[model samples]
Target: MGVDNYKLAMWTFLGSECFFFGSLIGTYMSYRGKSLTGPYPLDVFDPAVTSISTFDLLASSLFMVLAVHYAKAGEINKMLGWVAATMVGGLIFLGFQYYEFSHFVHEGLTLKSNLFGATFYVLTGFHGTHVAVGVLLLGSLAWSAKRGHLANIGETTEVIGLYWHFVDVVWIVIFTLVYLLEYT
Candidate 1:
């Protein structure tokens, strides 16, 4: 058969997401050093913590790959296990983000604090929202699989895997530019 409609739609959606995140990253970069206040990126950012969170997100991509592989092989149990693992990884990353945001606020970095605060929170918060959405999608997939409602597990899992990998790639860019580049 030709390309699936759902997969095509997902690719289109991801293309738009790329532009969306590009604009966000551009805005953040434009205002990177223009903050006229305390708690700048260097002052509040802890690379160590963010590094661990990045690792978690990256690991989730591997889980997503395994999930797709198992789904395609008609191994429902293994696919479900990998899906759950991916969701856990996403959740753990979110937990890290929550803690990091809390620490930033406690350190006086609010959205209204300065240019750095506004751009930083907006970009990273949107990313966290995307991660949460991915987790929910995986969760629904798991529920459907468990209930024997997902008829096309391989195709569905592959589509979701594409989204997950896109999310992970975006994080790599963010981690490099927003986090790692600060020190260089």
Candidate 2:
């Protein structure tokens, strides 16, 4: 009966993320190139920073897998360490997002500017929100482990890992379509 509810939860959340990110992408697509300003994607996007953040999020997924593996091995401390590392990676990505958004706003990409601004910000902003939520979930799990509240470490990590992987998958789409696909 070791079905791992933790992992199960992650799958369920990822299913929802599909629709969530899907809408974001759709909105962005519908509004692209409709900007009435000079601060368009090519004009304002710092692809290099975004590319690095994308890679960091991907790395966090790897660390999350390692954490789950350690959890299954009953290495509680190692599991927690990996979870902490994942959180740090997520934070770094968020920091990058904050900087990117701030830079865009400075360059006149406000949601009120035009359709392009509205869709672009909403889509990316929602993704950022998801990342923030994932960070919270990971942080809570880490805290639970530290406080000895987790009954089945493996199960918990499995669930958290599922969510973590889903987050990474979303970013993959975002980077490919939103960031890199700008030239397309």
Candidate 3:
């Protein structure tokens, strides 16, 4: 058969997501270093912690790839296990984000605190939300696989993997531009 319809739709959705994230990143870049207040990137951003979180997300993408690979091979249990691993990775990334945001707030940086805070929160908050949604989707896939409810496990896994990989790539860009660039 040709490209699966769901995969086609997912690609289209990801195409749109490029523009969505592009805008957020663009805005954040334009407003970078314009905070005009305390709690700047150097002061507030914990690069070491953020790096660990980024690694967690990238590792999840790897697990997602394995899930899809096993799904294509018709190994349902292996696929489910990989999917669960991917979800755990996503959850870990979110946990780091939650801690980072909370620490920023306690240090007096918030969306309303400054231009940096506003754009930073909007960009990264949207990413965190995407990660959360991805985790939920993977969780559902694992649950359905365990219950023997998936009609086409391979296609489902591939489609979700596309989304997961997209999110991971987006985070790479964000991590580079939003976080790493601060030191340059």
Candidate 4:
């Protein structure tokens, strides 16, 4: 398929994912304070740290787009370089996620803690999983680029960038609706 068609398909999939996550987040919002006993979101969440992680994820999107640009131009090395950077960003986000999840669990806010905890953990945890998957995809693409398996680096990079952008947009919503909105 052409790049435009490929992008359309990816976006469609992402649109569906939005609904999936929306339902999860909506459920979490609905049951936010239903837990019998707990440190609530504003009380327990480290908004500062999460904000930094959000920034990191967002920056990765820039690198992703740049990689796509380079690949399209047949600048293989530059594309690979950007892909590697994107993967690093994804890894850093995942590391931050690991720390955050661990901290929450230690604070007695876990998936099984209550309704809020269950919905919150499941939704955000799934997003973290998506980040990990994106990292793997980036790594594999870089590997293929290195080994000469990617005959069209630009198009492949564009496709990956599309997926990466989808991930970033979801985080934007999560950062705003799930975290910041709670405070306001």
Displacement of residue 55 (Cα, Å) in model 4 is 0.8
Model 3 per-residue lDDT tens digits across residues 1-184: 5879999999999999999999999999998888888788888999888999999999999999999999999999899889999999999999999999999999999999899999999999999999999999998888898888988999999999999999999999999998888888
Better of 2 and 3 by TM-score: 3
TM-score of each: 0.98, 0.92, 0.97, 0.94
Tens-digit lDDT track of model 2 for 86-140: 9999899999999999999999888888877788888888878878888999899
> In candidate 4, what are the lDDT values of residues 1-184, reduced to their tens digit?
5547767778788889889888988887788778887767876799878988999998999999999998998889998899999999999999999998899899888888777688888888988989999999899999999999977777777887888888898899888877988788
Top candidate, metric lDDT: 1
| Model 3, position 36: C-alpha lDDT score | 86
Which clashing pairs does model 4 show?
A: 71-154
Summarize candidate 1's per-residue lDDT along 1-184 as a digit string, tens digits.
Answer: 5998899999999999999999999999999899888788899999889989999999999999999999999999999999999999999999999999999999999999999999999999999999999999999999999999988999999999999999899999999999988899
Candidate 1, after superposition: displacement of residue 27 in Å?
0.6
Using TM-score as the measure, the top candidate is 1
Q: Is candidate 1 or candidate 4 better by TM-score?
A: 1
The global C-alpha lDDT for each of the candidates, from Candidate 1 onward, is 0.94, 0.85, 0.93, 0.87
Q: What stretches of model 3 exceed 4 Å from their correct place?
A: none
Candidate 4 local distance difference test against the native: 0.87
Candidates ranked by lDDT? 1, 3, 4, 2
Shift in Å, residue 91, candidate 4: 0.4
Stretches off by above 4 angstroms in model 1 are none
